[model samples]
Target chain A: MSTNATTEIVPGWETVIGLEVHAELATATKLFSGAPNRFGGEPNTNIDPVSLGLPGSLPVLNEKAVELAIRVGLALHCRVQRSVFSRKNYFYPDMPKDFQISQYDLPINGEGWLELADGRRVGIERAHLEEDTGKSTHVGGGGRIHEADYSLVDYNRAGVPLIEIVGAPDLRSPEDARAYVSELRSILVAIGASDGKMEEGSMRVDCNVSVRALGETELGTRCEIKNINSLRSLGRAIVYEARRQVDLVTSGGRVEQQTRHWDEAEGSTHKLRSKEEAYDYRYFPEPDLVPVEPSDEWIESIRAALPMLPRERRRRLADEAKIETAAAALTVERGMDDLAVEAIGLGADPVRVLVHLENNLADGIGSLSAGPFAALIAMEVDGNLTSTQTKTVLAVLVADGGNPAEVATELGFEAMEAEELEVIVDSLIAEHPQDWLAFTSGDDKERKKKAGFFVGQIMKVTGGQADGRAVNELLARRADA
Target chain B: MTEYTARQRISRSEVAHVADLARLSLTDQELDAFTNQLAAVLDHAADLEALDLTDVEPMIHPLPVHNVLRPDVVGETSDRNEVLSCAPSIENEQFRVPPVLGESP
Candidate 1:
């Protein structure tokens, strides 16, 4: 990974990177068809005639796809202007439709910014909406395309809406590129735009990397690495490609601009094809589908419906809840930050609730919606149950869905009156006379600690019904007397 | 007749290259026919450019909608038999298809 830093090529070489990340929108149906948008389905089972690209099958826009696109646009802080789909004229066996319906000149999202962890902001050139092609699986020996006897095509993913976000050539290193992709995925998931699962083909990235002399004005020959599925692979590919380009240039060999394949095992990019010039994919407006214009009112409604993004929510959790930054980050990372806030809103002490969630409650609950557990915490905070009684109530809540107060009553956690607690404190002080004497004496701080020990024992005897704060105050008064 | 002449910007070679990248095999005659047809289409597009579209924002989709989100509930659809019935091949309750080159062994 430090190959670039360790070996300086040409005194100073700067690496420039740009990315095109395709994220399948988390919708139930295909972008331009009624076919199901599901992964790992039986081949062709999710397909409809439109997705199969049959003749006379006019594509109908999926309203859900457009909504997801707009949600992404708003999350990226892009200008979601009225956009149009154009036919990217191309023919592929995988592409059931000869042309991919994609946005070209007028993308749905334009000119956004993504801030990386290192505080560097990468500009988003455009995020266009497009339909995905079908999958082609090559059959027969060694998985080689030429050696394959035949290929099978699956239309399950066909016509699925994919938002391709193109980033500017602002990423200087592989780390920045990976961080940019990671942050983008988080934002998409936060806004309910996409699942952003790279393994399931819900999110994928293609990186364009180039290396040029530090002071040079012209960019180097850039190579585009296709379909890097994971962030770790993305970082490795960028590093390896940058190093490879630098080695070629420094060795007096010309770096060929081309599309390359990232061999995950080899940790390098092998040449796939010579770089083609900007494709005049003969992008023209789709004649069949009408262009859509979102009204001002509609756009405003979407904006209003937008949830608090991860970054904003993290800040709010840290600021309002007075939780530690790391703890707040853990909540967000686990996708439970919203649940934490909801639990707090229901009257749980934010810090205590976070601690309980992290330490005790998280294991039993498979997901973040620890509803009854949250209710138990709220009950504890309300002084209706002690912390120990709350734990038992939590156990019952996890076992069965019943009222926490009722469970607390079954376990004898009903709160005691102040007068009853006062009597207990009085008796405890009378019994522990030696400790009370030391507590009254100004010299014995250690004995005063023993006095606190006796108070705790008295409260335990009272079945934790005595409020600890009130017990302490009563103990202090009796000891001084 | 409108005196609009469509400019042919893309050559035959470029069309062939695009087709190859997309992994579709087209005959020579088909390529030539598509080139001319695409040129005519572009000419019509040029006419659209002449229209008063300065204030008319380009529309992307048909409807005005936002945040059409589904609750992240795992829906009750685990019918593997129904799904695998459509596959050309299946093994171990999974869809079996022709392997692609460059995929990991």
Candidate 2:
């Protein structure tokens, strides 16, 4: 995909998107009770009185869930505050209790920013603690909710801890929204706050998108698109919805504030309800549960115990290896940045190590120590082995533990002598004089294309034993002469 | 002045709206009675609202307590058959509810 979106998604208009990501906390018990917070069970097997919302069942806050929530807040650089739980009242059968226990006025985390791989920082409004509701399956023709004959509810997920991390309206494009969610998911997984699994409903996203004329300070009536499970769906839904709103305004209609469901199959959104028809969730503080006041000492201890987050790790590798944060981010996320750093420390070329890490080791480095890895790169760097031979030996080293030199010898792979490379390159150039003319005097694109042709012939003659870099240098030098 | 403000504070339609939110189908007579009753309740609290509370911090809890928590551990879950049978409707080891209206938040 192109790095940046096209100039005008809709001409003379821009999109403002704020995403609410709800990640279920990884805790053994429910947020407000000991109901065995397991994902899948035989329907009601995980339910207790609290989860079922039986009359007179009181809620007890889970300490581990709070700690995980605090870990999330600290990892995201939000101000962990003394937060209170409120009862968000609405008519939902999934929540056996008429109201969902959540934080409204005060959230545990506030005002954090997640930095994308491109270094654009998206503002986080707040991450408030809440309880997840039960799962409902509409059991009728087409499984559509409104038209279903009946619905079945499983209380297994009810009362499980969740943190709804709300992002500021800082995104201007669907791609930016995806980047924000991706970076946030990485951070969530790094901190062990949530598994960040969208497929299993562990992390869900709701996007509030508004479009207005460019350079207009005020925002248009935003529509909320709900439950986009995957990153692709999030991006596509935003694009479709934004364009729909643009078409509506351009065709002399006003955009309405509504909760719309993303129809993945149709590639559009369907309106669930409008603002006037929206539920008046009368929010009030829960008298059952008190404010969660984590002391400064406790919060400091949690901050101390947090692992180095993904962004910080990316920055560390980028600085140490002198690579772009974008490339460093991929290496770090793949759990290979440390190996790359160690190889760089052993005097191996940092850029080459990153390239091999990104391309060659996609499966993973697998039991290969940094010592052997560094030695392999070092051989290629010192011209003792060609790029292809180095890759073959590195594969052997990565798959089965072996010395770089022994592996190269076992495979009968060696760098062509510089004079041998010269002979091959001189022959190829003579054979393709027309192409060589283009290589020497053609435009920049043509010169690059012809250089690739000569290099391919040299590699074929040497049976992948010739260094492509050496081939290019010889071709350029011959052309100059 | 008290009667006028009390009528303004609670309208019959507002009472009916609250009843609708609670999923209660109230009669016109019931709405009228509830409106006056709610207004009287608000009238009682009106004396407190008029106080100069600028210097006072809003109390979230009557008792000065906070941070009640329990350890995360797998504990006793209610017997499935027992709870499912008690539900108004049960199907396939799950609680069967009528066609639901709102999405879970």
Candidate 3:
């Protein structure tokens, strides 16, 4: 775990990075065909002739992909415009279509900004809608494409709608790059536009890395690093690639403009292909598809459909409650912002609710909805149960759905009466005469420590259901006497 | 009938690049022949520049309808067994092809 501490690279070189993130839209059908667009289907099952690029088959645009593209645009604060589809001519078996239908000069969304958790904003150059390709499974030696004896293609993923979000070279550190992807993923998931699962290939990142001398306005030659499948690997790849570029320049070798594949096992980037004047894609308008002239009304409707985005929700939660930054980020990241807000609205303490949510979200929320969970916390707050008793009731409620009060009774946790608690505290003090003497005779510091020790001992006898505040009152009276 | 004058000759290397992009293996003679043939076709289409249509909007398709989009609805998908049957070879129900030189491992 590398802390976000600034590490000077070769003393003077600063890393400049931009990222292109390709996210598969959560649509029901392919971008241009009616074939089912889903993940993990039987190989080639989710494909049709249009997705398979068969002869004489024409493509009909899936309106859902367009709506999702606009939803992302609005969430990212981008300019949604009348966009056109063009053929990005390329050769790959993954795209059975000789040319991919992508937005070239005019994308649907343009020029947005995404703010990271630490308030660093990266500029989004464009988020263009395009079609994804089929999955290729390589067989034989090393399982790498260059060494494979044969390969398999699964068209199940083919023609899935995608939006390639291009970012400006605003990320300065490797950690910022990771934050940028994570922040973007949260926003995508928030808007319900994408699942944003990098491991599942629903969201993929291509990093463009360069290094320049400190305070230099011009950028050094950059390399595009691909195949980083996780957020940790995304950060590691940028750091390694940036260092590699710095080493190349310092050692008097010019950094070549190329595409590099990040080898996760080796932890280094190897040259995939050197660019020969930046890929002449020879883009032209797709004669099969019509222009996407979005009406203002349609764009407004899409914007209205978007939920509260991640950044706005984070800011609002931070302002409304004095939640710590990390806890607030987690609350928003896991789609718990609304729950936290609703729980707070229902008179639960904001900080405690968010803390409990952050701590207990691992094994899934189970059957504990915010209303009931808030009720459980309220019970603890009102001295009906101790914190330990509350946690027990919460666990039972989550594991087995029931009213928190009912579960508390079933767990045999009832608030101890004040008189009973005082009697129990008196008995414990008599049993531990020296400790009780220290509590009454010692200074305030020793009193606090001894009181804490007594509280632990009393909790054990009470089965962790005794209220500590009541115990404190009884002990303070004994000391006064 | 008016004849379209030839201009902007296509280079043989350009032809070869296009063929490579299309994943076609072409010989030198085939590249030369394609260069001349594609150049003539482009030159003839260049006759469209002779017309003055500055006021015209660029039409993407010949169909009368614009925004010919299907509703965002899920429809019937082909059966997996039926779709995989169309492939030349299948392993684990996926289409098997000769390993391409540059693909994700």
TM-score per candidate for chain A alone: 0.72, 0.88, 0.89
Give per-residue CA lDDT, model 1, range A154-216, as digits (tens): 667878889999998877777677768888988998888888999988899999989988767
- Where does candidate 2 clash, by residue pair? none
Better of 1 and 3 by TM-score: 3
Q: For candidate 3, lDDT tens digit of each residue in A79-103?
A: 9987888998877778887788899
Structural similarity to truth (TM-score) of each candidate: 0.66, 0.89, 0.84
For model 1 the local lDDT of residue A82 reads 66
Top candidate when judged by lDDT against the true structure: 2
lDDT by residue (tens digit), candidate 2, A1-481: 1223353578788888999999999999999888887876788888889998999999999999999999988887789998899999987788887889999998888888778887778788898899999999988858877788889999899999999999889888888888888889898998888999999999999999999988788989999999698999999999899899999999999999999999888888999899999888989999999888999999999999999888888988998798788879889879888898888899889889998999899998987888989888888987778776777788888889878988887888765788988877888878888988888889999998988888788778887777777778778788788
Per-residue lDDT of B18 in model 3: 79
What value does DockQ give for candidate 1?
Answer: 0.12
Against the native chain B, each candidate's TM-score is 0.68, 0.81, 0.67
Model 1 ranges off by over 4 Å? A1-14, A115-120, A212-219, A277-280, A322-327, A342-481, B1-105
Runs in model 2 lying further than 4 Å from the true structure: A1-7, A414-481, B1-7
> Model 2, A300: alpha-carbon shift in Å?
0.7
* Top TM-score model: 2
Q: Each candidate: what lDDT?
A: 0.73, 0.86, 0.83
DockQ of each: 0.12, 0.72, 0.48
